[model samples]
Target: MRRSPDLHLPQATRASAGNLPAFLAACAVAVPVLLAVSAGNIADPIVRYDDYPALLAQPEGFWQKTLTEGRWLNYLWHLRGVVTPAWLNFVLFQILWGVTAAAIAAAAIPPGNRKWFAAVLALTLLPAPPVFLMAPWSSTLIPGFAVLALFAGLALVLSQRALRLLLPVFTLLAFTAYTTFPLILLAVCLISTRQRSLPDLAGLLVLFGASFAGAVLAVYALNWQVHGVFGIPLDPARSPDPAQDLAELWSHLPLLQETLSVLLGKLSFQSTPVLLFHLGLLIAATAVLLRRQPLEALYLWTALWAGMALMTLQVLKLGVTIPVRAFHFTWILYAVLIVRAAQELSRSPGLPGRLARNAVLLVALSYLVQTAVQFTRFRDWQHETRAMAAAISAQPGPVYATGSILDHPAARKAGLHRASSLELLTGLQLSQCGAVPEACAHLPPRLSSPAPEPQPQARLERFEGANVLVFPPRQ
Candidate 1:
């Protein structure tokens, strides 16, 4: 038989082919469980922040808003009527994410390597501090959409017999779900098309263009339906100046550094060694690939650049305080690179290959250990938060909360804030029998205090038919 042209792919035997589905099913279950464990206290009340209040307050209106905002399909999963207890709904969504990720791995990885690929992907999904797993706001779903879009796009470009038709459909779905995901899909398609024949590249480009245009048209139509025929909101504020945006991006360079640190699993001094070790392995693997498979190296580099470009654009558009979750595309790319590198090393023989493979395994294990520790700490924090909420709930009458659990040592250590915790408390205390209440007191922002001033202690004090809850600074 003629040798297959693709160096990375191995031929599938009959036994391996039969086992793929079972393996994928196992991965689908295992990944979400692992992620939930990492999240700590999965059964804890659904945390909330930002747009979550609106969603809880008005389910029907929220559904309508989603439809009018061009993300109508998200409502299929987000409908409050179908899924009770928002935490359970989040778990189900996470399971779907795992399934989608596994499907992509199955298409891209050869049968012999599927198990390893799945494990790496699962580890990548574990909640790192700052990159929270909860989707309190609509934009938080962007990472999940981006992952599915990239993988589906890769399957379309790499697999000859996979669901080629569905890839474009998936890409379009991701595009409508979040504005940023389409760019990721486009990047993947572009990189994948680089190795194809001229005709094949042209066809793929045409498909991508059509999908992009379709997504834009759909959004415009939705906007028109929600607003007027103008399809544009009438905001009185002046448009952001491009020059000022660029300057702001420059000023927020440290945010990018912090994002990279979190993505690399370097949240503390202890994890620093592991991060360095992984970086060294990545460098070695990149060198080997560049020497042996220049095209593949170029493809990886292009994907990394694409992710960075997307992040940079976000910082410029949204201002300097970019959320850690926004780096999901870049994080995904890093995981892919590390996993692919390890796989490539596995193909080699002799002492050097063994050492490289062992190093990769060690790094992965270290990441897991670190995550477990963080999860344990987070669990304790959740216990404390629940207790605090309970105490506040027992107090009768109107309540006003100031200061955030973000000020707590545990929360700060976990790189989380009280926003979600406070919101969850409000929802629980104010809502009746799992239903959103009509009106509730809003928590005020922490007041700015001068340095050296003693931080106020957290207390629930009664004040004439009303109560005030304050989160004291950590001792």
Candidate 2:
């Protein structure tokens, strides 16, 4: 009886068998801590943002409203009615994100590249994109789902029997779940097509096109079902011009550049040592790619360009400041490129290989330290928010809260600003905190006079038969 080829270990990867115990131990220790860190404010009864409360407020047929609003059929939205506890949502979100990241690492990285896999996993836990830790929104998890769907679809296309049958169903669900799925699928298919047979590659390409078309049709059907068949607009209102939009995007490029710099610890928050560690890893990766698979590196560069163009178009159309969460796909691509480069470098003999291994170690260490700092800050914010919510809940009569508590140095360093952070903390169903005017249009009139200055402490006041709580900027 012969075993399947897929089950057989490659000669290069056989050495990793010795490290399996170490990898498993690291995962066992790290995954729970990551979950705990991400679950910072989950225990707070107050909901975070508009969508959750809005959905909860709907009387019946809430799914219709959600569908009409052009929110992709995200799994989280459907769970609104079923999942009662606000914290449960965050817990499920962290778990799903963890599973998706692990699956992608397993599928994308070769067995011989176990060290890169570990590094990718560690980076996945880090708070480079602050929204993943600070906001309990489903959009933060979309990229993780996109990665899972892409890898699973690739397996299906490559004629893996079990995945071939399973992934088409998964693809349909994934495509409907996130608007970003199409762009991610395009990038993944383009990058994964190398070294495959021509016939199989052609089949994969066809599958990609078909899946995209199917996604479009599904969205239309959902819209038509909610609104009437005639309600579906064939041509939506067009933007002023692509040239104008591109110019606007160019003006905002500096903000995006600064964000990238911060993520790499190159600028702001003063983490120069961490920046140097990242530089070492990137330089080693580039050296390995140039020495070995230059053409593959070229393809990766092209994919990066395509991904960035798609993301920029989205930003321009929305006219909102770019959120760090939007860079999720870009991070996934970078991880894949680095892991491939590391694999090639690992096979090198002598000092180059040793240096490459050390670079990986340093990169992992830097991320771990950075993540620890971020977790502490997030936990502090969570505690403050919980206390504020409790105070608000204890007050009687119509309650109105003013000002923002997220003006703390740690929140600013984590890329959260006054407006966005306020939105996340206010407008809860359980608490007396009324929605800020900017978040929801319908709110009880304010009964308290505006403070002489934004308060520096969270305090409750009584005015005009209403409870007014003013949360001051964190001092």
Output the number of the lDDT-best candidate.
1
The Cα error of candidate 1 at residue 260, in Å, is 6.7
Worst 10 residues of 2 by lDDT: 234-243
Q: Residue 180: error of model 1 in Å?
A: 2.9
Q: List the residue pairs that clash in candidate 1.
A: 457-472, 458-472
Q: What is candidate 2's lDDT per residue for 78-183, written digit by digit as tens?
A: 5545434556555655555554444444444544556555545444433334435334454234434545544633442343433434445555565555455455
Residue 418 accuracy (lDDT) in model 1: 36
lDDT agreement with native, every candidate: 0.51, 0.50
Model 2 sits at a Cα RMSD from the real structure of: 6.7
Cα deviation of 424, candidate 2, in Å? 9.1
> Candidate 1 on 34-106: residue-level lDDT in tens?
5655465356523445345333544454454454345545544345343345555455445555554454444
My TM-score estimates for the predictions, one after another, are 0.70, 0.68
